[model samples]
Target: MYHYTAIQWIFFFYFYCFFGWCFESTYVSLKSRKLVNRGFCRGPFLPLYGSGAIMMLVVSMPFQDNLVLVYIAGCIGATVLEYVTGVTMEALFKVRYWDYSKNKFNFQGHICLGSSLAWGGLTILMTEFIHKPIEHLVLSIPDSILTPVTLVLTALIGADFALSFKAALDLRDVLE
Candidate 1:
């Protein structure tokens, strides 16, 4: 059976969250110019890394041996989540949060294959390779100490997301 330590699972959660934020920022930096010209606005919300990770976990539950499949699933799932979040946010805010659905690789308002692949690859690389090892390293610590630290880190991540969301709201002035 595929078993993971508590630390391992925690790392996966943080790792995916970090990747989501990174992907959103990276996409904005590299693609925003083009996206803007095309009439789409890059919303400030973090990309759906958590949702992707959750989806990946569920998919991987049934197929533990196939890492490749898991990675692929994570990438695709994350991309879809990101798109859905964007669409929902736009509807809630009455703004063009983003509009990749019309782009060449976009289908019905989501990113194209190119963007999706890039985000997915990065997420896999970070979560499977980088994050896993780091998690293991942290796990080697005594649990009594590690548990509290992990909780602190998770709280910090949540706070950071809140701040970023506020910043995104501020950016609305520019987008409008």
Candidate 2:
């Protein structure tokens, strides 16, 4: 059994989210032939699947002893997250990048292989491995540094998303 402090967990969440975003970006770029933002424009918001997986695993922290159950639970969480991202993005953006409405093995939407892999891998790592051991490693840091680091990282991600969105819109404008 492993244990981590509050700060470590926050750092882990940050790391997982960043890694998940990059992994999702690469996957979408390879599978959909577009970057993360482009994929968001051309396909469903699959990155949320990984983020959702992380959320699920975090929520289930108390029950990390069961690997199989954790993975299954994470998958369910990922599915719901996928749908939420899809619905929310549609409502917000007024367009859907991909349609899984008619596809087999899909529940009113598509969950691509890349997203699945990201979710599954994250589910395993977060639940079975990193949860407890890393807390000690991060807890030594001052609160001031931690707070600002998280804020800066979050802002950077937001900025990246905005830039990507602009580029995607520009491409759409050119195509039209």
The lDDT of each candidate is: 0.61, 0.61
| Candidate 1 C-alpha lDDT tens digits along 120-170 | 566556556655565566557787876777788767766766665566566
Give the clashing residue pairs of candidate 1, or none: 101-109, 105-112
Query: Going through the candidates in order, what is the number of backbone clashes in each?
Result: 2, 2
Candidate 2: C-alpha RMSD to true structure equals 5.6
TM-scores of all predicted structures? 0.58, 0.60
lDDT of 1 at 149: 74
> Candidate 1, which segments miss by more than 4 Å at Cα?
5-8, 19-47, 50-58, 94-102, 117-128, 160-176
Best of the candidates, TM-score: 2
TM-score of 2: 0.60
Runs of candidate 2 exceeding 4 Å displacement: 1-11, 30-50, 97-103, 110-122, 130-141, 158-176
Model 1 C-alpha lDDT versus the unseen true structure: 0.61
Error of 2 at 9 (Å): 5.3
